[model samples]
Target chain A: MQENKHIIELKYLSKYYKGSNVPAIDNINLNIDKGEIYGLLGPNGAGKTTTISILCGLFGPTSGNVFIDGMEFQHSAEKIKSIIGVVPQEIALYPSLTAKENLTFFGHLYGLKGKHLKTRIDECLELFGLEKNANRRIKTFSGGMKRRINLIAGILHKPKIIYLDEPTVGIDVQSRKVILEHLKNINKEGTTIIYTSHYMEEAENFCSRVAIIDKGKILTEGKPKELITAKGEYTDLESIFLNITGRALRDE
Target chain B: MLRLLSSIYKELLVLIRDRAGLAILFIMPLVLILIMTVIQDATFRTVKEVNISMILVNNDKDSLGEAISEGLYASDFFQIVEEINGEKITEENAKELVARGDYKIGIIIPERATEAIRGNVNALINKSFKSFNIPGVKKRTKKSTIDITIYIDPATSNSFKNMVMSSLKEFTSQLEIEMFFKNFSEAMAQLMPDQKPIKFDSFETIRYKEVYASTTENEILPNSVQHNVPAWTMFAMFFIVLPLAGNIIKERDDGSAFRLKTMPGSFVTVMFSKIFVFLGVSFVQFILMLLVGVYIMPALGLPQLEIGPHKIALAVMALSSGLAATGYGVAIGTIATTHEQAATFGAVSIIIFAALGGIWVPVYVMPHTIRIISQFSPLHWGLNGFYDIFLRGGDLMVVLAEAGKLLTFFVIMLGVAIVYNNYNKTK
Candidate 1:
């Protein structure tokens, strides 16, 4: 593999939130190659969101180096932001704006304009089976529709890398299928995907490579089938995850 | 530039769709301006148009009593009421009316006041003739002074009481001078009977004139419209905080702000866009308020607002004021954690600034300490700028200092917001 093949490099990434003794993410290291569907799987308070947030440059880690597309965040934040998209755990969209309007706004922020922006928005809407509701406000949308629109807003600029945090946590099965299938198509187009989710089975099937993280550290990291095979007693990724992270409650 | 324009467009769209917020941004200020202007106009008219009612008891019923009575009636400031309920008012009754607050002032002429004045004048003239060694001059009687009592309501302001007392003194001084001339002429006629008797009319040596100080040739007196128009307009402009801050809190809560933060440009771009949109709203609110003062108020029997001749200065002041108000809104929105906190603090803080800014009453009338505190309020700077143009007939140079203060306040508030936002992101 070429030196530039790895699109994202997280070297000793650690984060300690203000006024808290415990680190949210401690000395975590990962290198995500281009065109890979990578899942950061864990339970609540498992540092999955923290690692994703750092990768998306929503904030910087306390002591770490994050290199996105061979560029550092501090020196090339704007340049890095242009090539990446972020879909937060929340449905981050203006309820008053229509689906097309929301996509247009996000597209503008990403420096897309005119016919190109309009064309991209139309294509995304059609691909998501939401072309008919393009002019309808998000407030009038269903949970699944809103989630789809939120996803579209992030991907409108066709960024080279995308970070999705719980993208389909609360949605109908059909909407989830449509979203995951579209994500797969994007990933096939050489876009790197960094995803976080609590669904063990979804992660096992969707991610090309998976890392099960807990207590601010990764417990295991490998291809889903390989990880399951490595644990001979566990038949699937769900059993493997339970065996590694334990049944202890992490509700805090 | 494209980023800025697009962000501004997005903010405008979001603001337009929030109909309730739009109404609060526009109609609340409009109604407040109209209602407050009307209410204040009534109070202003009472002070400007109506006369202070006073009861007068003329016990002398002679020249001194008649002269004072005529003087009070001649002035437009006083409404003399000699008889109440069809009964002639006595000195005791006059005092009782004034003490009861039925009358703001009362004047009583002592019995034989005219005779006393005449006797004093005649004695002085006789003594002057005797000094000249003229024989047959009557023996000079002892000079006597008459005391005229004035009763004032305890509630009457000391300044108003002084004005009434000064007017009464003028009447008595004129009467005394005329009596002196008459008595001197009588003494001269008695000395030389052959000379034809000369007659004279009452004359004034000096006259007093009152004028409002202003730079322009035509000075606009401070009236309710002139005052309330700009006062409440500044108030309304600052009131933009409620909707502006509320919208920011909403964006933060809905996660759109976080999404924007992750976009291509700086989040400052979005903040600038919000400031521009809300600044436009404040300008609209200001113009509507001025229109109400100019057109609506006159129709409702109040004096039309005089915006003065410094149109350019007024626009500059308005722009600075709008910027300051929007900056404050952004600061509050950035600092507050929730919509409830933002809305409550934004509204209450603006109201406090308004009160201190002389929106309810002019700073000149406020207590000394409050007046000093008022200077710190951006609304006060804006109001002073408006007042300089409207009441003082000042130009751009005259209002520049106030405009500068408002602009400085804007910069400080914007800086605070930026710093607080940056701090929040790091934490």
Candidate 2:
């Protein structure tokens, strides 16, 4: 484990998917120190997920090594995984499993058990206003309800670092506020937060620093206000990102 | 009636939407029956195959030994494994073959089996002499007799012995009638001392090697419903792979799989849990299907699915079959990239196996090549097991052989699923 302020380091990471003509991510090097809420701001298909997946050891980069808290994924994947939580962009839950069952399962996955695990699940469910619906299957949940449970699922073990890929996407304003607030509360409690979103206003107010990526390349990386200053006249990240990466559709 | 028709209409709609489910619900069973019916008429005639294979020990080289050997060999209910038969098979070898489970039954025609024939003939001659009532006629008779020993493997169903004995009894009666006619011919010669001998040995019994395992001479009626019910039950059980694969693919495509990766358990743990769940589902499926087969079918005027004297054998069948189906389900479910892909692959593979395994057509009706292919199907082993207990009245050991096959399939498929999951994770 690294005894330094920076808890994560991505060194020259690139991912070329099998049979694909182009790499999903290309030569990306980045670092996020402890006690910072970082965001990867990008349009869809802009390699934001590719970067987070590598960071969480979901898949290995074809041409790079990742070090989480100075532990290389190749050597200490389990140890790294213990301290990192991942919230995937999709609502990743068993529709057949109740909220309590899902939480208990994921909690045990992170090595929680017994009354302590039960207590933690109750706490998480209560915090997300889902204590009443604990026994209801996740499939019956609305998009926002599922999103809240999804966030709670990732953070069950109180990992030192949590990565969320579009955690607030496609949810009601109330759900988005609760999720964003909870993410902030965890960051205050010393969890390093890395989130990605195309919503400029959310990233501007939320992340301490943000990297805007396009076509597998990072066009700019800085504290949001500083990036805005560099653009000379743009008031918010939307104008800055649009100006730097263009407004044409990037779907392919 | 309107509601019933509409319900069927709704079901059809659901099936159409589910390409995999539709194939299983209609295509597999229909294809199985069609293929078997076609094979049933084509050069493969209709002699029912006996599930029992016998190891014959004929030590007597006389006419009596040939009669015993040929009688069983010709019977539709018995398969005399010729490669292992002949005078070379000693009592010890026969016992060992049965004990080692290479064969379920062993029959020994003792070294002096000719005495059985001679004794009967002599008795007839003496009776003829007494009936003449001549002044100096003597009443002398042969007192020798040979015991035919049938060694049955207790591990198998007692029904096998019954079948063999049934055939043997028929053989004895026929032998007695022939000897009586031959003696009558001889008596005529003794009385007249002028006629050439009348041959009494021109009997031609039914031959059924072409139809394979002909049981016609034995008059062993097959419980067709028992065969059909368990067969389609297995076909349905293995089709558990469809929903299993669908669930896995759904999890994968929807991100639950990725969440699981970030969670603490190894991929093997996740796969095993799915298998365990499916095993439970399969067990329930077996019980309900069999309930319908045994009680409901008979109530509805169909042949009862006979459990015979081996209810534990049925339990073992259910347990092993459940695991086998679940293992198959877990394997394909994890390997397929999409739910439809998994469903298609699992359904098609199971249907092909069901057809080849004699689920619709009896294995006897298949072409020789297809019969050989059927052995490779786990469904074949399962069907053979059901037939053992139902038709052949086989015992525990008989069912164990089939259960062992299903268990082996479970182990192999589970191993593959685990390996494939880990491989995918690593890559």
Candidate 3:
């Protein structure tokens, strides 16, 4: 295993969905170093999810290659799966299960068992201020409570690299703050985060570095402040994104 | 390990927490069971009693004709109608009436029937032994055979025909034997020179045993109810599980499956856990309804059954077959894109399985090729298992081979489900 260094590397990774001429993700290269929050900032359909999904090894890229800590996804799928946690854009959680039960089940999938699984669940619940609601069914929970639990579900296994796809998509400010803060703290404790979102302001404030992509291709990449300065009078990351992606409702 | 167990625990918690869904899963099945049992019970009671309507035609104007008619009416075997048979009974008219299904049997006595019996009995014996040897004397002593035509409706059941035939034969044979004995005695007295004349007035002997009579008439009904009820119950139990299994697939499509996946267990473990839960639900529903049938319903005057060892064993085997059904549900759900599709597939599969399994009708009644096709469904095994227990008194071990076949079906379906989920994930 390639240890204690670069967590993710993507080179010439592209995906053309079946029966589609246009590719969802274009050939691009990037390296995600350890213990940093990297954001893939893009408009809808800008290959933001495609990139994160590739890193998670959900499916092989149509062409090109992805390596997690020097191991190819095709050859080291199980190993890669064990190390990386994916929090999808959709709230992927069992609504019928209580928070604790849901956590326990996911923990078991990662081969966790007994007291260790219970302790992890308890700790996550407490950290997210969800300890009191651990026994409450997820269907009874609010959207914010469910989002918090969703984040916690991925982190329970203590994966080295965690992928968050629009984690704060539809939550209230307070929930979003709590989730982002928890993610920041988790990253501080030796985890690499690759986040994707259309929230340019949040990406500017929370991410150490960001890439603005559109039409399945990256237009720019740098620290938000540096990029602002590089493009004269840009003033903010939103301006940079608007200048690059244009004003179009991405419905079709 | 612990994480996998926790995942299973969580899935079950979620599964149970949906109170409406849980209620439907538990209550709906029992309601259906109750309905099916009630219908079958009614059917069983209706098919057991045997009552046949008959037309009696008597042309004999003597006491012997009256006695024959009285004997048939006296027995509880037939319902005798007078208007259907006119004074003159013909073979053609009797056949036409019997074919209309209004009557089970028709009786026709020739015009000379009474005259023939009376002529032989009243004839005075010749006074000479020399005259007894004459051909004319022998011809005069000979008895005529009465033409009593008993027309049986071919459309009537085999058992009903047998009862009618046996009763008629007994009545006619007794009459003939009495006539022959009377004629022989008269002839012997006429030839005896030193014998006192025998008084035949007090010599009447009723040929058949007559039982103690009551005013109450025994009522008979059809026998289809009993055969159809138990047969349908087994079929309903075997086929109902398929639709419930579709609900399992609906949860997966709703994103609950992915949520469970991210938690800590193998999808296989969660799957097996659901199977266990569903199978338990189905089996419990089965036993509860049957208990109601055997115990509580009897208090209300319903026919209750005793739980024999064979019945218990067959119940256990039936449960295993239900598990196989759940497996098929899980597999189908995993492959379907939506709950509606899952439900449709469940319905379609159950119908096909029921048809093949001999639930809609018995395999014996089906053509040979269709019977062979029914062998592929898990329903067939389940229904067969029920038959072994409730009807045929078969035990668990006796149904093991069939149960094994169902278990194989369960395993294959489970494997397919696993492959489907994994493929979807990768795709």
| Top lDDT prediction, candidate number | 1
Q: List the residue pairs that clash in candidate 2.
A: B76-B214, B155-B397, B156-B395, B157-B394, B157-B395, B245-B333
The reply for model 1, stretches above 4 Å from the true place, is A228-252, B52-68, B78-201, B216-222, B355-375
Q: Give one digit per residue, the lDDT tens place, for model 3 in A193-242.
A: 88998888999999998988877887899899999999997999999999
lDDT of 2 by residue, B1-427 (tens): 2222322332233234557654564445444433333343221222345445887777888767788788877767667764553346678888888888888888888886765776667677667666787321122346566788887887865545666788777776676677667766766666656778777775667765632232223322454564566666777778778777776777788898897777544455666666666676677667766676667665655556555567887788878888888888877886778777887888789888888988766788899999999999988998888777666666678789889999999899888877886566444
Q: Rank the candidates by lDDT, best first.
A: 1, 2, 3
Error of 2 at A105 (Å): 2.6
Model 1 lDDT tens row, A115-220: 9999999999999999999999999999999999999988988889999999999899999999999999999998989999888888888999999999899899
lDDT of 3 by residue, B314-334 (tens): 566757766777787787767
Worst lDDT run of 10 residues, candidate 1 chain B, spans B134-143
lDDT, candidate 3, residue B129? 36
Each prediction's total of clashing residue pairs, residues at least 3 apart in sequence or on different chains, is: 0, 6, 30
For candidate 3, give the lDDT of residue A4. 34
User: What's the true lDDT of residue B255 in model 1?
Assistant: 85
Chain A TM-score across all models, in listed order: 0.97, 0.96, 0.96
Q: Worst lDDT window (10 residues) for model 3 chain B?
A: B214-223
Q: Please give me the total number of clashing residue pairs in predicted model 1.
A: 0
